[model samples]
Target: MAAPETRWLAVNGAKCRVRTKGTGRPIGFLAGLDGALTWTPFLERLAGERQVIVASLPGFAGSNGHDRLDQHLDWLLATEELLRGAGLAGADLIGSSVGGALAADVAAVWPGLVRKLALIAPFGLYDEGEPTFDVFAVRPGTLQNHVCANPENFAQATAQPAGEDAMEWQVTQLRTNEAAARLLWPLGDTRLALRLPRLTTETLLVWGADDRVVPPSYAGRFQKLIKGKTTIATIAGAGHLAELDAPDAVAAAILEFLG
Candidate 1:
């Protein structure tokens, strides 16, 4: 695959970094709380078949701050505007973690904008029994353990050279976390339960069997909420970041569903 082309899009005065790769059907990918810099092997595989457009959420990466846009609804509106600016309206959508919640919200509110929706370990609804981990409370090392099934892979992926580059990486992580906290601080739920019933687009939900951050049980909750056609797939031996832990499996499932 070739290197992704990067572009800055202005959505409601917020500059968002959008990365594009491959060609053909467009697939807009929304990253998780951690940010969108890391492109998992799953995404690379998907790129082979579709035009993948991944953007850093507001207040992360090169995107400008979103203090003016309050609430999750504003974020969804901004996302819709961003996609429209990129000429990706009616594109296939893929979201991870918080990104998943945003994608679902957009689809529910503007069903015509999304042709298909796929969510991987999405954070939207809250279940009292299967509560999500307090990501903000955990240290970086502990967070890694909660995020990845293979700690070694997490370490390797996050390792940075000791110098200004490493410092910059740390700063980026902090900023990304801060931005994510705005929406997911107290709890990750955005009351998507009530809105999901409005979704009419075909949806795919994938979860890791061993996801500690967001338990696999929430998959059932999503299945029940979506009134449209929905499919669920579980990738074994994977944790919260199933795309990173079981990229091949996750990619295959997504590809099959999108096909």
Candidate 2:
């Protein structure tokens, strides 16, 4: 299957890099780590099932420190406009990590716009006792290490022959952390924990069985709290970056639920 047709689209004070793939059914992609979406594999698997539009989303790297998108809610609003610009205003929402939090906000604010929502080991809940990963405070190495418990993925990413583009990405990752820390969740409630009760759209919750980042325990909370029908699936042999680790499973689950 062909990869999502990536493009550069503008949205409220920010020119977003958006990827539009497939055309039958529309589902928005929200990245978790680094904002540069890693949905290529999933896109390939689900190419025939539905249309997938992944947004690079306005952030610390591609963004220019605009005061308007400083608040998390504002970014969510702007993101919806970005999606609508990509011809996906009422499409299903697929959010991973930070994107999950944004997805929840969108469902809350525009209750009728979302057809369905999918969250894959998303962040932002900030459980009181469960260890919280401060995406900004950690070292780059630490972040990489946490991505895969096997440690091979980190070695693979680090060992891949270095190139000018890879170096640029590393720099972007480092700088974006600081800016993201400020605007990512300044208003708190990144999990939309309190707002789940009001969500009226059907949701599919995907989690990696080995996911130590958000932990599978939170799945129950998400399932129980959402007012809408929620289906849960666990992907084995996977960690936080399930799309990269187990893209096939992720794609199948998404296609089965959304298609």
Candidate 3:
């Protein structure tokens, strides 16, 4: 496979890093709390059939200009600019976790921007009876247990690089988490339910059956709230980051839905 082309774009006055690979109709992807600084196998698989364009959220994954967003409105506006600036308008879209919430928001506020939407364990709804797990409370070494079906995946992804790159990599990880906290702090819910009724795009809700960070049952709540044609897919043995645990399964589900 060839390397993805990288570019920096200005969106809502902030600088964002964007990447594109493959060819054909476009598929815009927004990654979870841990942004996609580089193309992963799961993304590469998606690129096999269509053009995959991934963008790092402002202030995350080495992107700049996050400071420009001071509130939810700022985020929403920035997201709109990001989509338009990155040429993702009117494209098939996919998002996971934090990115999922943003994608849904964009679809809701700007119904015609995304033709189809797929969300992977998106975090935006909260149920008091079945509380979402506190990802921040987990101990450093054991945090993966709650997010990954197999902890080794996190271990490998976070493995400190050798030599001069090690410190930079570690700092990026910490800052990424900090940036996520800005949006998901206290509780992950950002009242997305209130906006769901406005969503008109065809949607797919994909969840990891073994997810602990955001329980798989939340799929029902999301489905009920969305006004559009919505479907659900469960990947057995996967956790919060289903694509990381079962890339082929996630990719298959998304590809089928896109078709």
Q: Against the hidden reference, what TM-scores do the models get?
A: 0.93, 0.84, 0.95
lDDT of 1 by residue, 52-167 (tens): 88877787665766666687778888878877877679888888887888889889999799889999989889988878988789865666788889876555545553453777
TM-score of predicted structure 3: 0.95
Question: 1 or 2: which has the higher TM-score?
Answer: 1
Q: Tell me the whole-model lDDT of each prediction, alpha carbons only.
A: 0.82, 0.68, 0.86
Candidate 1 regions exceeding 4 Å error are 156-164
What tens-digit string does per-residue lDDT give for candidate 3 at 1-259? 6889988998777678889999999999988865775567789999999999997887777677666777888888888888888899999999999899989998999979999999999988899999888887878768778788998766655566455387788777776677677777778988899999999899999999999999999999999999999999999999998888888999999999999
In angstroms, the error of model 2 at 108 is 1.9
Better of 1 and 3 by lDDT: 3
Question: 82-125 in candidate 2: lDDT tens per residue?
Answer: 76787767888888766777776678677877888888876656
- Arranged by TM-score with the best first, the candidates are 3, 1, 2
Q: Among these predicted structures, which one has the highest TM-score?
A: 3
Candidate 3 lDDT (Cα, 0 to 1):
0.86
Cα-based lDDT at residue 135, candidate 2: 50
